[model samples]
Target: MEQNPNKPKILCVKISSNQRFFILGKEDGFSVYSCTPKFSLLFCRKFQKTGISIIDILESSNIFALVGNSKDPNFTTNKVFLWDDLNQKSIMEIAFPTPISALKITTRFLFVLTKKKCFIVEIEKRSILKSFSINSPSDIKPSNSFDFSLVKRDSLHIAIPHKLRAKIFYTNITKPLVELTIKLNTPSYQLIKFNCKLTFLAVVSPSGKQLLLYDLLTGELYQKFRIANKVSKVYSMSFTQDDKIIALLFNNSIVRFCSIQLNETTNRLVKIENQMKNVYKKNLINIEDDTQGICEFNEWNDLLVIYLNGACYRFTFDEIEKKITDTVSFNYLNSKEVLESKFNFNIEKEDERKHKEGEETKTGITSDKLNENKNKKTNENIENELTDLVELLEEQKLEDNMEKEKGIF
Candidate 1:
């Protein structure tokens, strides 16, 4: 399954659970497909470093989606087969450790984050070259839930929410490295969660029913405003590509958009000049449906809104008018639509790829179950030897002490 060079660009939003892979298309169709990972590894290895194909292994079923311009000759999997569409294939043989938390692909590396750790795999070799630990005891508890973004200019940022704090990590290093730790001023013991795009960070405080905005580059607080109490939870928040406005979704079926301005001044009081104007407010058609997640604003200026029931809406922004409107709904589950879409399928594929048995997984441990078994056995042997040695030393000391007492008597 390869991408068609001639098709229009579409955003593919995939959510995986134990049961099925929920796929939301940018065009007008949504479908649930079974995702398995067996053939996905085959496709990835065959196409490794060639940049000829992209493969996405869904978690729910044995099915996978393959997209790109060329197909790999060594790709194989009985459980993994192409979907009905000629352009994309669905694989059903492999599965991920946990549902994907975040995925990013660069020219040099593919990064995937699960609930516990971050995996960095080589795109060219189809092998995990490095693994990074993300969990640490801090004000924020390490959450299995998180999101990541690559800042084009100088850095990469990861946002993870623990019990009450959202920790942000900057992943860029240079001659003079830049790092900053900024904590959100929130109510005591209340969680202040956030979603990050390239330029802006959107923070949602549901306990207080407020949305806070921050400037990523300058570390300046942009806007702090309150939402309605009926808005039970602020599930998702995102900013436009230009950083001119922010969109927020609440549990109460209300979607709100506000205009934003950059107030740069020396005086703190005078810095808060421009007021946010409410652009649009709409009751979601499916009031009872759960929101899938907040969609990242793509380069095309389209904001994706995913509902928990497998429905997704693309909202386009009018910069001149400061208005946001729904552009289209993605409902099609065909392979051709997925192949033709221009959204970076490369990163998405990297996120879904998994290591096989005998191979090294991202945790830096061999995927071979036998390897772990052997390590455990070896550890037991060493422990037994150490225990015996300690006992012998203690007995010898006691014997020496007793002989000295006898000699003195």
Candidate 2:
């Protein structure tokens, strides 16, 4: 198919879990287009309307959530409508008290982030499981940040920035677990990107001088990338499923890629034993006309980037690496010289060093053990959530039957 020279401006774009499809949100309603190996559109399902601003899709399950502008047909920003492409119908919908700023979805739940609060709902039953106030004042629009735990599918966390401090809360708990206080006395950092696997959290400093990546599970300052050149802002970014690669978007249509080494010795799957290699200064070359938007790596590890102009670019990991081959470098911090061991003794040596210096190591070890225990407990909570979800689905079925008796569809 020939490219439309006058195609409607692309508002947003998302790739499927399988990486075989691309979802485009334009000034009109959104469309699903098959992504051919050559990056051409194989099929198009355009739902014409005034606009579709927010779109979240779990393409593997054939489910999507769309938020439309008020000008669109039967659309309102205050509500989210769930659609099943297989049925070609709206299965369920939820109305919020305020207009939604952003949203995310998985097989487990749908997260809606409004200006002042966040709402989480079970997908199968469309039942509200929990909601909380974000405490972001009316005038100061909140920077968007939310993701499900990468280590556990059912766990979720959201970071809300208010002034110099940021509050990060998990869905299963009411209290904030991670509160980031910047020493710069600035209002807040603009960019907060959380890896879904819960491996790391990336944020652009308020001064825009550095990019900070933190170890989420350990709360350690994993690495820092100094920003040499000044840019307007970081629009969006995403970590690959393995948390080994990250892509960032900056002003003037530039996207930079970085590689990460988690410093795992024995097994890559074990989270507790892994440490991060220090990431140092790296020069980034500019990409094509990406005025504004986001980018992410699909499950297949292919890079999918969408711009405000509605153009979507897909590149294999090798292709991206080749393009920025010489633009990346990193450093590893070793405070104490210790021999590398096959038994993953870097952590043990650090504990030993702390003990010899008369500095208590129990607090650090206790914290790591606590996180491991929390992971196990959350796993059990997920199973319980699923059981409750089944009951809620049954209730929905009964309600639908009564509505059918009343001749309502």
Q: Report the C-alpha lDDT of model 2 over 1-409, residue by residue, as the tens digit.
A: 1225565545566665445566666655555554434344322334544466788765333457787775533677878876544323454567898888877766567778887677778765558877766654333224334444322343455555433245444333323454443232224565677765555667666555566766655555556665426644666667777776777666566666666556665212233322333232222333344355566676556666655444556655543433533211111110121221111101122222211222222111112322233333322332343344334434543554465321111
Query: Quick one: best lDDT, which candidate?
Result: 2
Listed in order, each prediction's TM-score against the native is 0.49, 0.63
Query: Which residue pairs collide, candidate 2?
Result: 10-310, 150-196, 150-197, 163-187
Each model's lDDT comes to 0.41, 0.51
| Number of the top-ranking candidate, with TM-score as the measure | 2
Over 94-116, each residue of candidate 1 has an lDDT whose tens digit, in order, gives: 22354334454443344565555
Misplaced by over 4 Å in model 1 are: 1-12, 15-102, 125-145, 151-155, 160-167, 173-176, 187-199, 206-208, 217-220, 263-277, 289-293, 296-300, 322-409
Model 2 stretches astray by more than 4 angstroms: 1-9, 17-19, 46-50, 71-73, 135-143, 149-153, 162-164, 170-186, 266-290, 317-409
Candidate 1 backbone overlaps, count: 29
